[model samples]
Target: MVEIKTPMLPSNKPLIVGKIDVRVGDHVEQGQVICQIETAKGNHQIKATEAGTIAEILVEEGREVVANDVLMVIDEQGKIQPEQQSESNKEILTTVPTDTVQHHLEKDLLIIGAGPGGYVAAIYASKRGMDVAIAERKKLGGTCLNIGCIPTKSMVQSAHLFELLNEMDLFGIEGDFHASINMEKVLQRKDEVVDTLVSGIEYLLNKNKVTVLQGTAHFLSDTEVQVGSTIIKAKNIIIATGSVAASLRVEGCDLPGVIDSTAALDLHEVPDSLVVIGGGVIGLEFAFIYNTFGSKVHVVEFQKSLLPMLDADAGKFIEGICKEKHIQTSTSSKVISIKQTVEGEYIVTYEKDGTTSYTIADKVLMSTGRRANTNGLGLEHTSIKTNKRTGEILVDEYEQTNVPHIYAIGDVSSKVKLAHLASQQGCVAVDHMLVGKHPISDTNVPSVVYTNPEIATVGYTEQALKEQGIPYKVSRFDFSANGRALTMNQTEGFVKLLASEDGTLLGAVICGPDASSLIAGVTVAMTNGVTVEQLTQTIFAHPTTSEAIREAALALIGRGIHQ
Candidate 1:
C-alpha cells in the first residue's frame, strides 16, 4: 500500500487541487498523471510512481492542499510493502522541482508537542468530535510524565520509604532495619511508570482516531505545519511544546558533575554530597528527594526566601521543614562559580549578603528555571505575538494568541509552568475555539509542591492580598490539634484559610499530611463561592484530615470547635 500525497508548491501555502484524472476504485498503470494542482510557481501534475488501484480519493478537484498532504491512497500491486507506505508518501513527487504533495486529509486541529497541555487538549477536542492530529517529536507524554512530575514523585516515594526506615521507632514499630536504594531499580521503576502513562496516551489518541504524527514539527505557514515528510494544514493549531531545564550562566556549569533536573532524576547513584542551585520548585523538590536518599543536600538561591514566587509564610514554613529534615538552605545567595577539584569534588562559590562563600559537593545541580522552547518552530516568520522577555507566546485570557486560529497553551505560553495549569489552559483554549467562551476562570487554580508534608495553595496568597490591600479574614488551624494528624503522628504544618468579612471563601494554603488531596476541597469551595460558614457546616467525617478545613473555617468565624 502507498499514499498519494500532495507535493509542495513553490511555497508552503495550500495548493489548489485542479484536474483529477483518476477516481476511487479506478485501476491506473504506472506513469499515469493522477491529478493536477495549482501551485505558487505554476500548475503541476501529480503522477503515480507505480501501477496501483486507487483505494481512496480524499480530496475534491476544487479543494486546496499543502505539500505532503495525503491526496489519495493506492494499492501498489505489491511493488511496495505496506510498511514502506510512509517512505512511499515521502517519495511521491510533483512535476515541479521545489514542491511535492501527499496527505490523506486535513485535520480540524493540529496540536504541536504532546505534553500534558497538548495531550489533554487533544483528548478533550476529540471528545468534542473534532478530527485532531497531534505531532510529538519524542515521547508521547511530554516532560511531566517522562521527566518532570511522575519521575520526581516516583523518586520521592522511594526516598520517603528509605527515610522512614530510620523513623520506624517513632511509629511504635521496632526493627533493626537497614535499607538502601538500588539506583538502577529505582530508575527502572520510574521508567516503567512513565512508559505505562505514555502508552496510555497513545491508546487514547488512537481510540479517538486522532492522527498521531511522530516527528519534530515546524510551522510551514500560520495555518500549516510540517512534520517529517508531511505538511499538515488544520483549521486551528495549538502549540503546547513544554519548557526545558535551563542552566545558570556560571563558570563550570557544563562540567561533568553539573546536571539539570532531568539528569538529576536518572543519576547512576545518589551522590554522597550534592549542591542544588536555585531554591525554586525544581531545586527544592530534588533537594528533599536526595536528602531523604541519604545525600548531604544544600540549596543556594538568589531570592530572599525559598520558593520566592510563593507566599512569604509558605516559604518560611517550608524553610523550617527543610531545617528539620537537615537540608541546608542558603537564601539571598547567588552562585558565581563552580570549579572542580582533582579529588573529584566540586567547589561551588556564591555571594550572599555581600560576602563570598563556598561549598563542596560531589555533584552540582542547576535548577534555576526553564526557558520557552520556541526556537526552530518557524514562528519568527509569523506575526504571532510573544513575550519580549521570556519569548513565550502571548495569549489572551481565552488562551488564544494574537493570531486568531493559533492558540498557545502550557509552558510554551503560560507564566505558570505547571502541568495541571497547562492542562486547564488547554481545555480553555479548546472551549474558546469551539464555543467562543471559556467556562472556567484561572483565578482559583491550585498548585501543589510534593514536599515531605506537601504544600498546596489555591486562589490568593496572604501576601498578594496584603499587597493589594484586599479586605480579608485569616485563620490558621494547626494540624497539631487534629486527631487524625495526631493519630497518624505526621502533624507538622497548618491549614490556613482567608475569607472575606462576610464569610466568602477567598483563599487557602495547606502544609501538612494529605495537603495535596485536601487542597482540592478548598479549591472547590473558593471556586464555587463557598462561604466560611457553609464550609464549617459541611459534614466532615470525624478524625479525618479534612476536618482541619472545617476547623479553619470555624476559626475564621470568631468561634471554633477546636483551636
Candidate 2:
C-alpha cells in the first residue's frame, strides 16, 4: 500500500484541497495530476509518484491539509497486505478504537501553539530537565516566522534596495541602472529565508529533546490536553495560540481583489494602484513597500494621523515624508465601502471631514490589525478566564491564568503581541513555573515601525508624562545636523528625549535611519534605571547614527556641544 500525502509548500500555512482528479477504484499512472491544492501564492497540482489503483481517498476537496498529511492510499496490483504499522504512522492515524482502552502520555509540561512563546518555553523547560511536549496546528515558527515579521521584513529589505538603486546618484555613484521589481524572485527569496529560519528552530527543538505533536490541541482538563486523538497528561500547560488578522465588515470587503496582510505578502504582480485601509504599522510598511515598487499607494486612516500609537511629532514627520514620496494619505477618514468594477478595478469610498471621496485602485489591502485566537481551545471546560472586551486570555503578572496549573502567554494573553515580547514572556513563564515567581513587566518594551526612515521608542512618551501629570524636560537632536545623516543623505527625522527634572531618563524616541537598532541603547538604560547624566557620560562613536542618542542626552543637561 502506498500512502499519498500532501507535499510541503513554501508557506507554513495549510493548503486547501481544490479539485480531486481521481476516485477510488480508478487506475492512475505515475506523474499524473491527482489533485489541485490552493496555496497563498497560487494554485498547485498534486501529482502521483507511482502508478497504482486508488484504494481509498483519505481527504476530500475543500479540506485544509498540512505537509505530510495523508490524502489517499493506492494499492499496487490491487493487493492488500496486513503489516505492522510504524510508530509515526500510528501517530498520524490518531483516532483510537472506542472499545480499546485510551492511552495517555505523561509529561512535565505541555505547550499548545508552537509559536515563539510555546517553543521558547519548551526549550527553556527542557533545559531545566523537565520533559516538554509542544502541539502545533501549523508550522513550528508560527505567524511571526512564517508570515508576520520575517517575511514582511524580507520584502521591506527588497523594496529598500530597489529604491536605493534608483537613487544611486545621490551617493556620488553615477551609473545608468535599469531596475524593475521582480516579485517572483522577491517572493522566492522570502520563502528561502523563512524556510531556513524554520529549519533552524526545528533543529533547536529536536536538540533539546522536546516532543513535537502536529495537530490542533484542546483542553481536556486543567492539566490535560487532547492533540488529535492522543491524550497528554501534563503537570502544567501553557496556552500560546497567537492571533488572527481582523476582518472588515464593510461592503465589498469579501471581494476577490480585496485581501488581508497575509495575501498582500504573496502577491505575484505589483498592482498599478493599492488602497490601504489602515494607517497602522502594518499598513504603513506595506504602503511604503508597494509605493517603492512603483505602485500608486493611498492610505486611508480612521485616525487623524499616521501611526496613531506613536508620538504626534513622529506621525507628522512620517506623514510629511509620505507626501514627499508621492504616497497619498487621507487622515481622519473612515472607509465607507469598496466596490469592484467590471474591469477588475476597485473603487474605495471613504469619508473625510464629513465629505465622501473615492479612489480607484487595482487592489485593496486591509491592514486593520489582529485579535487573539482562542476560539476552539475548549477553554470553557476549564476554569481559564478571558477578557470580555479584547477576547484575550487573562493572566497574572507571572503569566498564569485563574487555574494555577494552566498558563497563557503571547498574543493569547492580554499583553503586547510582539514576537520578542512573546519570547521574553515565555522565558519568564517557564522560570515562574519551574524555579520561582519572577514577574516580567511590559513598561520598557521597545516598539519599532519598519517604515522608510524607521521609528522606535522605549519607556514613556511625552504625552503620557503630561497625561499622568509627571514633570518632565524635553531635549531634541535632529538627524539633519548629524554628520552621518548628512553623509548618508537620509536625514529626515530627529531623536527626542524626555527626561525628569532630576536627570532621570524618562523616555526616548528616534525617527531616523537605524532607529530600530538605536532604540536598544535607550531600552537598556531604561531597564537598568539609568539617568540622563549617566547616558551623557557614556561615549558614543563619532559620525554614527547612535551618536544622536548621546547628543540628545547631553542636550537635556545643557551641554550640547555639536548642536
Candidate 3:
C-alpha cells in the first residue's frame, strides 16, 4: 500500500486541506493532482505519487492538516487483502482467530496472538518458505499496538506538542498564542496514527501470503490446537499472548470512577482532578500526560520512590521534576480504599507511616502493574511447563519451552514485557529452527518510560552493581550543560554512564530530551562490546543531544572535555 502524506510546503507550518480531488476506490495514475492544500504561502496542489486505487481518504475539506499526516492510503496494484474478523463478545476473546486458506489443519508454523512477536514471526517465517498461520481473537495488532506502547506514546507526543505551543515565547515566536488540548481531535489523531500502522502491518502480512485466522484457539494436545471447530496440527507453535493491565483489589476499586490503563486512554473529558494509584512506568507516564493536559494530578505510590524498576538516581530526579511541575505525590503510602461521593467525586483513602489520610478526585487510576496473560489457552491440555508463581511460559535462550516444538516469546514468556524485545525473541526462535542454533542475548534491552523528560536505561543500574558487589566507575553529564538542550529549552535531566575499572561499558541511563532515541546508540555499543575508549574516539555531531553521550563517555575515561 502507498501512503500519500501531506507535503512540506514552502512555509513549514500546518496547512488546511482545501479540497480533495479524489475519492475512495478511485484509481488514478502517478502525478495526478489529488487535492489542494491551503498554506501560509498559498494553495498547493497535492499530487498522487503512485498509481493505485485510493483505499482511504483521511482528511476532509477545511481540516487543518500537518506534514506527514496520512492524507490517503492507496491500495497498490496486486496487493492482497487479509481476511477480516470482528468479535462481538468480549467475554470469549481469549482464543485466537481460526480462519484458514486450505481448510485442512496441518501447517508449518502456528502462532497465537497477532502482536509484535507473533506477527513479526509469521512474516519472517513465511519469507523463509514456511507455511505460517497466525490466529488473533482480538484486533490484528495486539495490546501493544492498540493499547499499550503505541497508544501511550501517541498521547505523549500530543501532550508534548501542547506544552511546546504554550512555551512558544521561549522560541521568540511573537504572537498572542493560547494552546489547549482539544481531546476529541487529539483522540482522532491518535487513532489515525494507530490505524495507519495497523493497516501497514496487515498489508505486510497479506503480501507475505501468511494465512490469517480469527477466533479463540487452544491446545488440543502438544502438537495440535483447537480454533473454533477446526483442529490445527503444526510442526512448531509459538505462543505470543501478551499481558493486560492489572487492577488493584482494594475496596471500592470496582467503582465507576476507578479505571485501569485502558480506561485511562479513552477518558473523553479531562477530569478536574485525578489520583494515580501506582508510581511505576504506566502510572508516571499517565500522571505526567494528564498533568500537562491541565488536570489537578496527584500520584500515590506504594513504593518509597517513583519508577521502582529504574535506578534510584533517575527516580529521585524525576520526583524533583514532578514537584517543580506542581504534581502532588505521596510515597510509601498504600491505598486503603476508594469511595465515590453522592456528588460523583471520589475520595481516596491511604495509610502512610501509621497514619491514614484521604484525598479526593474526579477519577482514580489503578496503575499498579501487569501480570502474564496466559488465560484460556488450555495449557493443561499439554505437558508444557509454566512458571507456577507468575504463570509465564518457561522458555530457554532460544525461546523454546520445555516442549521443544512449542516456543513462547513475549509477555507470555517473561515479566520484562517490551514490544521490541518480543519481536527480537521471535526472530531468534525462527532462526534457531532454520539453523539448529540461534540465541540472542537480551542483556542490553533498553527500557523507556514516556514521561516528560523521558527516562531510558540499558544494561545495569548502579543500584544493581552495588547489590552484586561489582566494582564500577561512574560518570554523569547534565543536559543543563549541553548547548543543544539549551537551544531546545529542555535542559532538565542528565545522562549517567557506568563502566568497569578496565574501561568497559557496564550500563547507562538517560533522562532528558531524545532519551528514547539516544539510548539506541548506547545499546548498540554495549551489544557489540564497545569500550569507553573506543566510543570517545568516534566523533559526534556538535550542538546535538547525542554529544552528551560522548561527553559522558569521556568522563568515564577521566578525559572530560565540555563537562
lDDT of 3 by residue, 143-232 (tens): 988888888888999899888886777778879766777889878777777765675576578778888777778887999888766678
Question: 6, model 1: CA deviation in Å?
Answer: 39
Colliding pairs, model 3: 95-216, 95-217, 96-215, 96-216, 96-217, 97-136, 97-213, 97-214, 97-215, 98-214
Flag regions of model 2 displaced more than 4 Å. 1-103
lDDT of 3 at 548: 95
Model 2, range 339-442, lDDT digits (tens) per residue? 99989999999999889999999999998888999989998888888899989999889898889888888998955788888888888888988876789888
Q: Which ten residues in a row have the lowest lDDT in candidate 3?
A: 78-87
Clashes of each: 14, 0, 10
Ranking by TM-score: 2, 3, 1
For all candidates in order, the CA lDDT equals 0.86, 0.88, 0.87
For candidate 2, the 10 contiguous residues with the lowest summed lDDT are 77-86
